[model samples]
Target: MSTVFWAIVVLGALIFVHELGHFLVARMMGVRVLVFSLGFGPRIAGWSRGAGETEYRLSLIPLGGYVKMLGENEEEDEEKDQSGHPVVVADAPDSFANQGVWSRIAIVFAGPAFNFLFALMVLVMAFMLGVGELLPVVGSVSRGMPAEQAGLRVGDRVVAINEQPVTRWEVLSQTIKRSEGVPLRFTVERPEGPILLTIQPRVQEMTNIFGETVRTWLVGIGPGSGTEFVTYGFFSALVKGVEHAWRMTDMIVTGVWKIITRSIPADQIGGPLMIAEMAGKTAEQGASSMLFFMALISINLGILNLLPIPVLDGGHLLFFLIEAVKGSPLSEQVRLQANRAGMFLLIVLMAWAMKNDLTRIFSDG
Candidate 1:
């Protein structure tokens, strides 16, 4: 099915880009990678490659991939002379753990960086292929809806919300969603002309296509039907692609901030189930649409990985930052203890997200 294919394709590309970051950086840092695998678990097909003892592979599981750099675990390799302390590889140039803090940091951070870049590439490509922004036109207004009550009519161009100019329909939607039930002063351009309206949103339970209910503040307005695929010049695509990535990054940052600040509900969290659902549907639409979603998710992945929580790149980065400030790495004992703490925290977070996802998935039905 197209959905399954797209889901797999997106997940595969994401894992590949992430692993590629680690692999390339390891190579650059002179670390010997034992294996660069496109998937996890038992290898279905693989082979060792030029100048390294590592196997470049396609494994059984497509969910994840890894770059198994030499000296990564420090427990597996045992080439000691007399004592239990292992002998260091003096000959092999590329060893991940052997690299300095900055190099290691760079290697770790590259995964997320590449994801963002990949997303940017997708956005730029879509734009170059002629993706048009949605027009600012009201789709529906409930009889007693805020828009109707405030005299906001159809075919109105929503120029601004709370005096903040919105150039894109996407921006307008996001602004309204995050307004926190405030009485929003919207500058709408009706057929007769522009007018300011104080539109108040009420908390309403809305059912999605999946039959899941979401309690959201509704402003009772929607953008007009359809978007045109507007092709772009190569240069413009590149520039716009980066802008798209930056915008996504910003949105993710703000969303996280809002969650932490209690401006948004904790139930809004999601995990793989939500993502896979989106990916499956998006993939069926075609490359351009899939690409758009991929870029969005890439930015999501990038930002998510950067959260300073343990068992994540951000957690590792946080440790590195502390090491940088302290003029030495955290003690192995401290690192291990912190890691345990992080692992616990990460599990809790995942559990929460998964719980929310499950609740949303089943409750409406």
Candidate 2:
């Protein structure tokens, strides 16, 4: 029950922020927003400021949300009344379709932009409040692995990898992963003083978060069972936050590329159930962990929405770009067909992810 609650809260907050971005930007562009909803399906609870104004709603479904704008679904046409006679509506000037191409582009892009910025802000707060991280000390080396073969021992503190300094296990792991089986020089601090060891990372297949098998470089060294709380000054935290967000973005992009190349299976994709379980587990770990997880999810959502696929923010931007180039929008028929295809693809993907989630649950049970 707690897990369900946290999952809803986390997802709700992210979705609200995303929709808020669109709502604010659309308003700025003089678009009349018809509805601001926090979820899909029938409205469960809501309030309206006045007749014909935006209706704020909390819907039945908590998995997703949307902001509906006036004329968002209508192509520019002669205004008509219920009798099909030409007439002007009171807020026709505020129609989204009547806005300039650039304005529409900005409104569409704002959702993803806000998600990324929210991640940065959350990261900064987490850093300022202090978060625990594993130190760069070797706890154990797996037998017959690259680390052991290179004579790495317990208590040896890794100082650098190939002349690049590493003070944390996270940085060390990233460095190893990027080595791509290349030989590396490890500078370590031992009781006998500093020592250099040459090691070549082994290419190994590992299961990723989505349960998809992916190949990565590994040195078979594990961090000691010790953690250190790290806190940064205000300015340092801000800088670190930006760096953290960028690193996460790069990692996500690389993961997507690997998936596209079929280096990982599509079954690795997960849906809401997986997210709920993760949210629960992270919440149990404490406030810092929960906040960090939120930041990570925000970044993922931002990047996912920016993929150049129809029915997404990136697709809208693509349409705007083409319109700018051709001096007109695509025909209504083409746009409708493209959107239908995109929606179909999305539904199929969601069903597959749900299947994976259910499989995991049943197998675990």
Highest lDDT against the true fold, candidate: 2
Cα-based lDDT at residue 303, candidate 2 = 85
Error of 1 at 160 (Å): 14
Off by over 4 Å in 2: 75-91, 142-152, 158-166, 171-220
TM-score of 2: 0.84
lDDT of each: 0.79, 0.89
The positional error of residue 130 in candidate 1, measured at the CA in angstroms, is 2.2
Q: Write one digit per residue (lDDT tens) for candidate 2, span 173-280.
A: 989999988899999999889999999999989987645678999999898977899888889999999998998899888787777788777777889999999999
Weakest ten-residue segment in model 2 by summed lDDT: 73-82
- For each candidate, what TM-score against the reference? 0.74, 0.84
Q: What is the lDDT of candidate 2?
A: 0.89
TM-score of 1: 0.74
Q: What lDDT would candidate 1 get against the real structure?
A: 0.79
Q: For model 2, what is the error of residue 144's alpha carbon versus the real structure, in angstroms, after optimal superposition?
A: 5.6
